[model samples]
Target: MTNLTCFKAYDIRGKLGTELNEEIAYKIGRAYGQIYCPQKVVIGCDIRLTSEDLKQATIRGLNDAGVNVLDLGMTGTEEVYFGAFHLDVQGGIEVTASHNPMDYNGMKLVRENARPIGADSGLKDIQALAESGHFQEMSQKGTTEQYNILPEFVDHLMTYIDPAKLRPLKLVMNAGNGAAGHVIDALEDKFKQLSIPIEFIKIHHEPNGHFPNGIPNPILIENRGYTSDAVLAHQADMGIAWDGDFDRCFLFDEKGQFIEGYYIVGLLAQAFLLKQKGEKIVHDPRLVWNTLDILKEYDGIAVQSQSGHSFIKDMMREHNAVYGGEMSAHHYFRDFAYCDSGMIPWLLATVVLSETKQSLSSLVEDMIKKFPCSGEINFKVKDTQKTIQKIFDHFADQKPMLDQTDGVSLDFGAWRLNVRASNTEPLLRLNIESRADQNPKPMQDYVDELTQLIQS
Candidate 1:
């Protein structure tokens, strides 16, 4: 049997030609159909040049395996997630590599109601079947049909906030020439029909496979200047940018400063809690103080989960959480079948802005000051476990409280840090934070100490 390296812990991702190609895509589709044997499945693709051909091959495999296909042409990841749960299909697949390089492509799969299918949940089975080239013959073949899910998807997004509460505000949006442009256009049309007074200044808003601007990842420091610059030049209220598949969005305040996703978690938690008291909110372990403080004041329950989307989604389903936010900018909502959405976060942030009559920075400035964080720092390491043990030994004398949920989190009362190996890369990720009132040392001091320790 041929080993397939494209199957990852969470989803399928690999470099094209060698790791993944049309033939392999077909095998994946056939394997999924053989294992699940679902009568109907929903599928969509991003604007990548190779995506359409791969999608067609996948469709052929699904049809050959007797599973009908509903194709949503050119959609972001969440759109496929929406179709999986909202439509009468039993599963969905999104042909997207997100922020990966042009030579790479991937797929995100979900079962009924948009529940993720990670390695622990049926991904391994599909991989085995595909690797072995197993087949089951059927007399009847399934059919393929084209469908438009944008209108329904946009309508569902509107349910997250009240249009009446929105004020006249200007927004700067940079789509990075990916799949997000079409969704933005549909939302803009809806706003005009409803007479909302929000103005959108769009840039790089067309879907071009070449990615003329970049790969659409706003998380990179180099890719953020365009969005921030446009926000400042237009005097906009807020600026938003998204990655290729548009699953996670990064935000910039009115002053053109990039707000860390950690603070946005607290902001979103407060927004939901204000509307309904006693709601549950899930957050990752990487950063916690700001979220906990806000939840305590709002009389909301806070639950902590590991750092991945599948783990966070499972925890949200278990706790019936109203909202879940990761410091990595992935936000999940109970209303959206516990799936993460790039579009939802910014929409809710706008509502918060209008309701409080405050700027984006003002709403989050206190949280940033109260709990200063070093964001996330990454380093390529030779041995992750050995490095973690070294750090633990160094801090053993202080007897800091430790939490090993997703990584090693050491709480030293006044300041805390979490260091973990990256899930998708061979790198160690670190995040440190300090309570401004409780610690006399600056946040940068702790950052430098950790950097030196990790490097040495």
Candidate 2:
């Protein structure tokens, strides 16, 4: 029996040979096929070195379980979701590690209409089946066929934003050597047809499986320089960069300042609200002041949820939310079956700027000043539960008035902090937000105090 440790809370992920391999992937595929038993299944993968091999193994497993496969070769996570909905497939699975290190990989599964299969849903059953290593034999094996969906995906994306509406602006786009470059190249051709005077400066735009340096995660301070340099060199209106699988994107202003994902969430939420007045928008509770305030001003309903793709997507479907976003830059859309996409957010942001006649910087200027955040700080600790309890106990006196939605969020008059355990790591994630009048000093001081406590 395969080790069940790789069966994560949300999806399957682990190191390459030791924890995950072709055999394990094949078993997972068979288990997913047996459990869902859809008429057809859509499969896609990122550009990690081991992805193709894993994909083959997964397809074999699915085929063995009598599930026909529609292979969307070498595409983003969203493409698989699109294929699932567009082709009316029974379900879909994207074999991607996302922004994880090269040595690691995982799978993101979905039912019909791209509905996610999370822990509470069907992932646990699939894990149990895979671990049991038993399955009913099929009368006839399923078949596999390859289909290229890039052109179709690009065309669908363009429907959301009119290129002619955009102003003449220079933009820098860094694909971080992921699968986004091909899609971005196709988008550039579409922009040319509209006569929109835009320059696209690109870096690491190739789909290299080696990932040369590391998975192109822009959140790390080290990766910021590449995007920042491109923005400055081109004197562009803004810079947009994506992670390894293009499931999440990061942004930079013309001045080369890294914009927080929370701010983008508010920006995009405001944009959507303007179009559909009083529409419901879902957002994570980690950073809510600016977003909630903006939604209220627009007379729209603000729905708060826990941070994570599965949680946010589920809430979006439940509320029939027009849009949803998390602090991690994962953006969800109603039109896309409530699935998160790294490409659509930037496209929608561009359209928002075009309609508002405001620069990206100008749109988010006030939001930055309104909510001065310390970003997310991670602490590697021995005991995650004990650490969380320690922090919760320290602030227990103020617990009655605090927000305990997803974690322990304590509010003072001027500042607030949210400390929660990471679902994917052995670390406590801390986020600090301060009011406009308060100096960031107090926030920093609290962070220092908390860090010391956690470390000790």
Candidate 3:
């Protein structure tokens, strides 16, 4: 059997005509149906040009396998996750190539309760079956039906905050020409119906598959300027921008300054801890200083897990954690079936700002000062293993505390570094942070030292 390059460790993704196509999507659906043999499954697609056709092809295969399908047309990835557990369906799939270039398309799969199907879990098996073009014919075909999950989804989101308590604040909301526009419109309608004192100043509000304003990713410095400029131009209280599928969102403070996601983790952890003081919080090992300190002050337990959505979700389930966050802007909630949401985070942030009566910058400025970080820096190495080992051996003499959680995390007295290969991308990521060293010397020295060892 030929290997499909699109099948990554976590999900399926690749260029449109080359690495993936309608045929691959159909076979994947059939393979999944045969393996799970579920009575019903949920399906959704993003605003990508190819997603709807792929969604239909996948449904055809699932129907061929005698599995019923509930199609929620043109939605965010979180909506598919919501449909999986929120409805009486056995599994869910979303056809979306989040943040990828124009010519790419992919899918995210989940089993019941919105549990992910990563490589170690069941993705390999599905790949094997899909690669081998063999299938069993069924006597009867399953049926397909259209379902609208927006109302239920909005109802679920409102549970996070009381609208009446929200103060009047103008928000610069940028959908980035992705699937987020519909959700924004829905929320706006609800706000007007409920008379919640919130105003949304929308930019790039329409869903355009061509992405005329460039790809819908806010993480890139070049792409972030639009949101920052909009916030400043509109004089809005804050700004929010999302990627293509709207599963992950980046935040901007009132001053149009981008907030590092590491501190946002701490901020969100506080939001959850305020409601339930002793509940658990699961965080990635890459950046933990801020999360740990905040949790300690709030009497909340912080559990460290390897970075990645699958690892974080599993850890949250095992610990019964109220929330789990990665420094890369992915925030998972226990209420949302242990799945991440781009929309929920900003809503909760608004609530926090209203309650504390502070600017968004004021809330996280102190955390930024206390634990200065290098943010995440990526390096492409010819040999990732050898590079990591070189850094580890060079630091052996220092005898820093080491944790092999996601990658290798070495803790010196004044600073700490976590180096690991990315699960999705082809690069090694390094994260460094120091305690109360507002200056760059401590962080810079270790970064330079590590870079030398890694690239030497």
**lDDT at position 316, candidate 2:** 94
lDDT of each: 0.93, 0.86, 0.90
* Candidate 2, 191-261: lDDT as tens digits: 88877677788888888988775679888778889899989988988899899889899989889989999
For all candidates, what are the clash counts?
0, 0, 0
Residue lDDT tens for model 1, 1-456: 989999987888888999899999999999999999999999999999999998889888899999999999999999999999999999999999988889999899888899998888899999999999988987999999999999999999999879999999999989999999999999999999999999999999999999999899887788999999999999999999999999999999999999999999999999899889999999999999999999999989999998988889999999999999999999999999999999999999999999999999999999999999998888888999899988999999999999999789999999999999876656799999889999999998988888899899
Off by over 4 Å in 1: none
RMSD of every prediction: 1.4, 1.5, 1.7
Model 2 pairs in collision:
none
lDDT of 3 by residue, 1-456 (tens): 767878876788888888889988999999999889989999999999999999999999899999999999999999999999999999999999898778889999999989999888899999999888688999999999999999999989989889878999999999999999999999999999999999999999999998988899887778889999999998988999999999898999989988878999999999888888999999999988889999999889999988877788889999999999999899999999999999999999999999999999999999988998888888989877788888889889989999998889998857888999977656899999998754447667877877787777
**Which pairs clash (backbone N, Cα, C closer than 3 Å) in model 1?**
none
Off by over 4 Å in 2: 438-442
Can you rank all candidates by lDDT, best first? 1, 3, 2
RMSD of 3: 1.7
